[model samples]
Target: MAPSKTFFSNFRLSNIVNLLLRSLQLVDGLVVIGLYGIDLNRARKEDKYSDGKWVYAVTVGSIAAATAVVYAFVSVFMHYRSLTFLFAWDWVLMVLWAALSGIFGTMYLNEKVEMEAGIHRMKVAVGFDLAGLVLWFVTAVMGSLWFFRERWGGRISRPGKA
Candidate 1:
């Protein structure tokens, strides 16, 4: 609720979540400006410059990169603390998250396949698309929670526990 007292505090897990929550405010920005530009360029205008599409892609990329960087910055700042739980699930969750995201992207692309052979009937790739999207959403949420779990000392490690 209150502003952080220092840079390190601003980089805390709760603060990271607050930053992500604030990022929701950019949804309209992405829709209006990033997804479809407001320039006077005619609607009939060819995307020769590809400005709208580029904006869309770049905006998504930037948001993802910024989120990762902010989390990394906070992790670096908290290095002195015994933030060991971060190690327990971070890499595993990160790998799974990446896999799910890749599946989502690939399925999205594959969902548009076209065919012509009469013998080769068509089938909807809807299942893959749905599964991918579901996995992506779950992975994103879990990954974020894992990233911020250390904020409350959610886990404790014994000296000999693995």
Candidate 2:
């Protein structure tokens, strides 16, 4: 009998982290959208900076989420040993995005607080933002370690081998 093909066959811890990252990014996007809607409904006048901040958050979250999902699928489903460069690039980009997301989330929360937005909605948004940031940070660290291992850590020569 032939062994069945399954996702677990090619799965790695990094893949799991990628999936988690994407899921958290998707949730973050949704939460940002919800916050934007609240701001729109409650605003007495247009505030470009406020609206722009939410829009930026939504855009970054969405793009990062989509990229992560696609990368996860490709990394797991495809045999791309010859594409190590691409894989490394993906990890680099994800780490950069995670850092940016964390900074943006913190700034958004601080701005919202200073604006004295509604306590209930602000609190909810803050909670979601923090959760997403934490997830992103974890994914970034995991991805970095995986990339480094692939590139450098695993290169130690065997005891007597050339």
Candidate 3:
């Protein structure tokens, strides 16, 4: 039998989606980092009871961002076959990250609205959080498509047993 000329075999959609996922992951990570930094600064300056929430956001965001950056770098720079074992887990993580980011963004936006004044920095942080949520969702979707494409023998068929 000869080699198939499917999308995955020729590095077409899979490669494109992989690159897009990596780029979005990088952007999401950076945005989360920025949000964490801003939240940290705000916590330090305000010292409000609710600052603990920001601290929690920062802690979670930092870890999530770091994970995203490392994953993005590996997915982009390393050989494709070398990371095949991670495809399933990567998509799962992206979904989880998307959901968590959406929750965090909503929380921050709510907090921003509750504040009376001097919320410029918090607003910026909330904006970044929102951006991160969008990026995470897109990345998750792309990753899922790539996963299904590979699993379905690269024909873009309905997701099920081949």
Candidate 4:
């Protein structure tokens, strides 16, 4: 959906991070489809994917939607606020985490697709999964904390006193 004017007003650094996370998921989903060899003929004829492909599509699609929402929120936020130190840090971290996840996840998917290639041993695939999981977890936790802080945390000061 196109962003609304109010979206600009509610921008937050955390929103941008969420945006990156979602985008990565979208790309990952596409990679999964390609790597797993999507049955385009079946999809077109049957109007649905094969067993596993459907799951990947739904999960990745959800992420893409969520990312779009974050994009809207961040665009709105940026409208009201300058790109200050906090904003820059948030963007940098978000991009870094997303890129890391993409790299490892792509490797994992590619290896899974071409098991006969033998370039990535079983042990190596396990390592890639572990690394991807770590990055995903860390990014999720940080994004959630930022969301909570922006949505709920605020100074509760005594009235007219410090």
Candidate 5:
């Protein structure tokens, strides 16, 4: 495709996708943090915050949001392609979100367990946590696409080639 000479046209399609996904990441992180932060505060008041699941959820959510902000600055706002290293970090973030979602999911899905009264909130958190995982996974896939397109250069050699 020929490059267009317009303000919005200057940006690549993938970059636009990254921007939208990063926006979703920011929102998912904030929602997860808000969902758990209130409980975290209450737990702290009750002296259980240090060992509470809410603490972990809030911390991971905060990190996800912070990372999304920086990534958006470098990748979208600066009009830079996906940094190769971000692929690894994206996987790491995906795993963290997966863990968060899995833990909450089990709590929310299991009907036989009567563990905590707070498990009721896990239903909402599971959705946002899973959303975080999906967002990071999509970012990682995009980064991989960039890497393969730029670095792989899949040139096949035939046996008859001299």
Candidate 6:
């Protein structure tokens, strides 16, 4: 159904969970950006220098935040659900988060960190990225169910739901 149709219809438990998860995704992304961004800004102040690692992390965090906002808005205002699109994006996010986690983890283990606070921030960043990975995985599974719903005698796709 179109988002407009769902808006006035019953508000199900799934809707609440959807909103909660999306909100968490958005916040988690912002937190990672903020954590890495502090170091990035400090580096700029010290000598107009920024580490590539922090830059890459911040970029990924920005992408995560933007996806959460855009997808949530579109799902609410345009379609009640876009299963295929959501599924694709969830997987994309999952990979990005995994990469972020792996990169930060490697960097930390390599003993290249310079400051205690920086170490703390990196650990937190990895935590958030892993959380994002799990969240995306969960959403991807939910999206998969939508595809199966059509095949298993659940609600078949309407004309434009594809």
Number of the top-ranking candidate, with lDDT as the measure? 5
Q: Which stretches of candidate 6 lie over 4 Å from their true place?
A: 1-6, 109-115, 151-162
User: How many clashes does each candidate structure show, in the order listed?
Assistant: 0, 0, 0, 3, 0, 0
RMSD of 1: 12.4
| Consecutive 10-residue window with the lowest summed lDDT within model 3 | 1-10
Itemize residue pairs with steric clashes in candidate 2: none
The lowest-lDDT stretch of 10 consecutive residues in candidate 2 is: 79-88
Candidate 4 lDDT tens digits, 59-132: 44344335435544554456312322233334443454355346545655555445554345423433433443
lDDT of 1 at 62: 43
Clashing pairs in 4: 7-76, 8-76, 11-77
> How many residue pairs clash in model 1?
0
lDDT (0 to 1) per candidate: 0.40, 0.57, 0.58, 0.46, 0.79, 0.77
Query: Which lDDT tens digits does candidate 5 get at residues 1-162?
Result: 543445456477777777788889999999999988877777779987365577889888999999888887776545546465577788889999989888888777664436665665667678788889999998988787777665755554549874
Which regions of candidate 5 fall more than 4 Å away from where they truly are?
1-10, 111-119, 154-162
For every model shown, what is its TM-score relative to the native structure? Answer: 0.28, 0.59, 0.57, 0.36, 0.80, 0.77
Q: Which residue runs of candidate 3 sit more than 4 Å off their true CA positions? A: 1-24, 38-50, 79-117, 154-162
Q: How far is candidate 5 from the true structure (C-alpha RMSD, Å)?
A: 4.6
Pairs with backbone N, CA or C atoms under 3 Å apart (clashes), candidate 6: none
Query: What does each candidate score in C-alpha RMSD?
Result: 12.4, 5.3, 6.8, 10.1, 4.6, 6.2
Instruction: Judge candidate 1 against the unseen true structure and give its global Cα lDDT, from 0 to 1.
Output: 0.40
The alpha-carbon lDDT assigned to residue 141 of candidate 1 equals 55
Task: Find the 10 residues in a row with the least total lDDT in model 1.
Answer: 117-126
Off by over 4 Å in 2: 1-8, 40-50, 79-117, 155-162
Question: How would you encode candidate 1's per-residue C-alpha lDDT over 83-133 as one tens digit per residue?
Answer: 434333334433443453354355344453445431121112223223323
lDDT digits (tens) for residues 1-162 of candidate 6: 997776747545665667677788899899989989998988888887787888988998899889888767655544435444467778888898888889887767555546677776677778887888888888778867765664465456678776
